[model samples]
Target: MLDYDREAARYDATRGGDARAEAAAEAVEELLPRQARVVVDVACGTGIVTARLRRPGRRVAGIDRSAGMARMAAARLPGGVVCGDAAARLPLLDGSADAVTMIWLLHLLDQADSAAVLAQAARALRPGGRLLTTVDKNHAAYHTGGDVAALLGPVRDAHTPPQSDALDRVLGVGSGLGLTMSGRTTFAGLGQGRSPRSWREVIPKSPWGRRMDAATLAELGSRLGDLPDQDHPRPDPVYTLIALVKQD
Candidate 1:
């Protein structure tokens, strides 16, 4: 995956800012249990959106692997955020939280690591607690309704970065851990459309894109350059949110 520590400085500015965070927070909160007393957001980079998860009578915590990201998170969440590897174990006590979130995390990990994170998330929850995760992050451009979107299909499919089958893999991991798929919803990625250069920059930042051969990148870049709105952004994309519950 991209080096989060290095990217922490500019992370918020490029990530659609507060508008996107609000949309994500709303979707996450809606999926939470009404009685949820404590919630944790895993891989909560920058804690921009994680901060918005806070609600009256509910405590919010953030976890990340990057110290830089955690530093920013601590500013937003105070002493509530921890910098550590969740795949190994979270700093929180077992079954301490009513909800554990891995928003935009699974798609970045491979099968084994993804399973590790899922198990950890499930372990941190009380019986009947929920785990929320977002799948298919990079393919956001594919779902937009605009000319730029129409041109992105070929490029997105060719450079596929963990969008398709992400949910199935998550469900498989959850079920193996005795967690069940509880619910799902969609949220708009507000102000997230990107110009060609912005979208291209995103490629090298992803795990898959970093490994892609130079020839493939060149071909995709050429195809993208031919599309309209080379500098102007396309329509904003939407994200799918899922909720998995650890049964009591």
Candidate 2:
């Protein structure tokens, strides 16, 4: 595991303000009841999403394994933020949170650990409280074409992108731990559909999109240039926001 502590400062810069974070936040907000108050942002890197959750009367907390990440999150959030691992025991009490949000973090865990994390999230949520998570689409089996090797630079190892269905299955495992699916939202167009024109026109338009420097942006354009047109069917990275509610 990359110690996100050392990389916390630059992680958001590298990923840009991930759109998945916004989508996940929206999902959580919508799923939460009007009275729900306390919310936990799990695997909160640099507190970007946590900052967005700050509002009057709504208590927000952030938890992450990286001390650096927690520090960043705490600086942005007025609520309590703790440095802790998501896979193991969370530093919160059972049924302490009214809602939980996990963004762009599940796929990082292997199958077993992922389930453990989900279970722990469920444990922390009060009965009927919601849990929102964004999971990557199944790309390893569906992705074809595009200069993946060139874009990533130096293929270190053969890794499979977690299947969307596999993520659902993991959630199912957490069902035994008392979480039921309430709703879902999907956000697509991550790391795909970058044309030279769109890259130039769109990449600089948003904070998350603006992190790419001129060189990296040009390199991405060049590598993707050889591929079929953006219209071509490809494995688009989809972020699925699953809303799970704790069953009483």
Candidate 3:
């Protein structure tokens, strides 16, 4: 797994200012009840989503494994942010939160760990509380012809390409974890090689992005650009937002 601790400082500069990050935050916010007061953001890297959740009366706590990321999140969000692993049990009391949200975190885990984290999230939420999560839309792979090559090029420790059905299986892992598929949204960013300047801004902040240098970035741009533009399609690198309700 990529240790976000080393890249915490540059993380926001690389991703926080991007349109995709804003869209993901907006998707999470839409799923929240208008009057919802408390929320937990898991793997809340640098409070990208947590910072956006701040409102007059709402409270948002962000948790991550990287202390540096937590510090960054704390700096941006008024609510407390803590350093902790999502794969293990969460630090909060059982049934303490009104909602729990996970963003771009499911693909990082193997099947077993993914199920464990969802169960833990279910445990932490009060009965009928909401669980909002985002995962990569599997359908995008077929539409984007060069996705596999691009994946091998940049994303290191690449977990299995996420499937659309994975979230339902994850929710079904536990008996009481009844989830309602609230809705799904899609986002497509400039793929590798399409725009070097844009990719440069995004690459250095992520764990994989940190490994790429200017030269490699340029190469990616060239190679990816060489491919036909016809490959790009709506929601080429799409994501699905899942909303689940904890049942007693």
Candidate 4:
């Protein structure tokens, strides 16, 4: 994964920024219960979404592993942000949170780490509390079907773990922990859709790209370069979020 600390400064800009943040927060809010007074956002990079999650009666806190990310989050949330690892343990007390959110977090990890984060989120939720997370993240980015996806699809599928943030995978992980899927929602990734040229630059440096042989990488680059609208963004991808309710 890219160094989150180093990426902190440009994270929002490279991401969809405020527009995307608003869309995400709005979708999350739709599934979040009004009575969920205390919400903990795991891997809350820069707290952009966390800040938007706040309301008159809701208390929102953000936790991130990167010091640089936590620092930026702290600025937006004051004393409500902390530096912590979700794959290990969240700093929050067990059964204290009314809701827990893990937005855009799980796909970055292997299955074991992903399971650990889910278990931690389960451990932190009160009975009947909700855990919301993004699933099928790897697939979301490539939904703009065309030459770009055709060229990169096979490589991505081979590199991506079958259980990495898939809905079934997340449901299975949560099953043993008394968490079950209750609802789901989708939101547009506003500024995140990529162009042929962008994919050429991204695929080579991406985590999966490191596993790709030199010849394969060069071939993909050449094909992507040959595609039309090299600079035009494809249709934006829609991200899926699943809500799991802890058993009472």
Tell me, by lDDT, which candidate is best: 4
User: Best by TM-score, which number?
Assistant: 4
Q: How does model 4 fare in lDDT?
A: 0.90
For model 4, residues 127-228, the per-residue Cα lDDT tens digits are 999999999987977765766777777877787557478888899889999998988999888988899898888898887887788998888789889999
Q: In terms of TM-score, how similar is model 1 to the real structure? A: 0.87
lDDT of 4 at 34: 82
Note the residue pairs that clash in candidate 3. 193-221, 203-209
Tens-place lDDT digits, model 3, residues 97-209: 88998886776677778787887888898877888887644433423445434533434334234442365565566444665555565544323122323433444565554
TM-score of candidate 4 versus the correct structure, residues matched by position: 0.93
Candidates in order have lDDT scores of: 0.82, 0.68, 0.68, 0.90
Better of 2 and 3 by TM-score: 3
Model 4 steric clash pairs: none
Q: Number of clashes in every candidate structure? A: 0, 1, 2, 0
- Judged by lDDT relative to the true structure, which candidate is superior, 1 or 2? 1
In candidate 1, which residue pairs clash? none
**lDDT score of residue 74 within candidate 4:** 98
Minimum summed lDDT over a 10-residue window in model 2 is located at 152-161
- Residue range with the least summed lDDT across 10 consecutive positions in model 1: 156-165
